[model samples]
Target: MLKFKTMLILLVTMSIYSGNAVASPTSQVVKDRSYYEERGDIVWEVPTQKKTIAFTFDDGPDRKQTPKILEVLDQYQAKATFFVVGERVERFPEIVKLVLSKGHEVGNHSFYHPSFQNISKEKAVNEIGKTQQAILKATGHTAVLFRPPGGSYDQNIINVSKQNNLQLILWSWHQDTKDWRAPGVQRIANKVLKNVRNGDIILMHDYVYNSSQTSEALKIILPELKKQGYSFVTVSQLLSQKDNPNTHIKVTQ
Candidate 1:
């Protein structure tokens, strides 16, 4: 009994040290996009026949990068979604308002950009509530869409979002441009131009650490995608048309 107890303690120590003890990604269930979307708990991408894609920019209301990205979008007559950080929205209200005024949609990204899975339920609620208040105060538009920081979420995050009436949104698995990594202009452009499909929610960031390459990548992506017969739409617009009876949904791998 003593030897068995000693081995169990050693194993527990090893597990903790290896970081295997941390309960993360909270939801244990691994399912497809349709499962979450149908339940309305989370939405990664919507099915559609309009050939419309939702381009969502996170961590924004950036003073410099945002306006440049806006210019690129305007050049193509594309409509996209900007998921604005709460504090940034507060500091750059005009930028948030400009995003709305420019025929784009703004969604709530948490105030401090903390991963919801890492925080407690109370703090998670505060993060969503405060950000919602900030966006509404600044843009005079309530955000109906909420994308968790770093795409991190748990049941608590989902519950709080439903209580607040915000749709929890995520990007298509294939359409993440990873612009925040500053993965080079060509690579970012290539990710979208190559993998893009109807109903994809493309992820790009308007506010990245230090300088942003996203605005530059957009110059390459937007025109080529437009030529490929793709039109960008806000996430809400994509969701609205997803259930249209006349629309034919495509098979996704």
Candidate 2:
């Protein structure tokens, strides 16, 4: 029993250490993008007013969660951005329609959501290109914004996005739901509510094991934000400026 207890303690320590190591990679990637690399024409985050936030859903247009999330937004009269994957959009075209019809914006999350930093330039182009075309065909609108898979990017990827005339978007803040672990709905909701601020961009997955939690959290978050004088807007609306024509531009082209 003594030996077993000692081994268990060691295992716990190792698990914590491993998690820190895994998280470090994302931080490193962000730092690399922020300074060491020139991101060309890709604007990582949108500038917005105080007390405003953009809620963006990534990897979605999902049949199950996307509709539920839309219903919640409808109840609050809130707007959001859905960064839909190309393959998924091809599979669930109706979800894209619902997103647009309901007043939400759709952006490109890529055709397959591959890692831009690791993939070749040709593959990177296809990743964004196919999705851009799919979004255009399905919704009859062109996607001007993109978020790279896993937030991994480099100079070549930025150049490709610029060539495609895309604005590369990233998050200002993240609510790490870890919903895949099936963390309870309340826990996810509280985490997001606690961390959100003005000019914040919250990231949540539309298709995942914990998608239900994401939907539930948004219901609580929207009302709470409203009470605090915050208005939910799609990414473009949140990032737009009166002086810049692109601010109010939609996908129609």
Candidate 3:
């Protein structure tokens, strides 16, 4: 009986030590990269009750319109995401850095703004890969979000994005400002204000053929939204609020 009791105690002690050795703090638990990679593709708008929206601009690093839009956002202390064309980024690297410096998020739009649905898988991959390289080179930051040119995407785009570890971001149809059409500034602002809602992703452009109207519309949209108690955030920040309610969004600078 004595020997059996000693053996039982030793087994209990060993079990305790083994448990201690494998124990990990909740905060220290690391998820596999695939865990995040699997979440990639197709984030249109986060579903949340919070009155937060994300404004996403595409095809930019425009010397004129980008600066003007940034100024308007700065005046309202709002944050946004810029889905920049890699070729344009290379041409205007300074504007890329300026976008980042002003506390906005930058995402890869594509190298040449090609429609993904019409491209081969290899071409899609190359487009995404080259833009990823360009963004890193210009900003020293790897972009994890990609918005296909013209918001057109397919399974090929999703596969390429997963292979490159990028999330495919799209905008809500209702919130598209259509400023690229150069609709009068008031009309552009009205399109957004009239259709805006919680958890919306507003789409606008900075380097459309003529985006002066976009810059003008922002002057009205930003202040009006602020007055309506809507907070503008980056795409990642808006998604984070929905995915991890406990997570606080630290505005990227």
Weakest ten-residue segment in model 2 by summed lDDT: 16-25
Put down candidate 2 lDDT per residue, 26-144, tens digits, no spaces.
12233433342132344434444457777788888789999998999999988888889999999999999999999999988889876554477788888989998999889898988
lDDT of each: 0.81, 0.70, 0.77
lDDT of 3 by residue, 1-253 (tens): 9998896555333421121111111112323323322454466667777889999998898999899999989999899999999999999999999999998999999999875535777888889899999999998999989987765555666678888888888777567676776778899899889977777888899887865888788889889988999999999998877845433222111
Q: Score every model by TM-score.
A: 0.85, 0.78, 0.79
Best by lDDT: 1
Model 1 residue pairs with clashes: none
Return whichever of 1 and 3 wins on TM-score. Answer: 1
| Maximum-TM-score candidate | 1
After superposing candidate 3 on the true structure, give the runs of residues whose Cα lies further than 4 Å from its correct spot.
1-40, 243-253
Clashes of each: 0, 0, 0
lDDT (tens digit, per residue) of candidate 1 on 1-253: 9998896556433421121222224455534445555676787778776788999999988999999999999999999999999989889999999999999999999898875545787888899999999998996799999988767666777888888899998777777776777879999989889988889998889988776689888899888988889899999999987856433344343
Give the TM-score comparing model 2 with the true structure, all chains together. Answer: 0.78
Worst 10 residues of 3 by lDDT: 16-25
Sorted by lDDT (best first), the order is 1, 3, 2
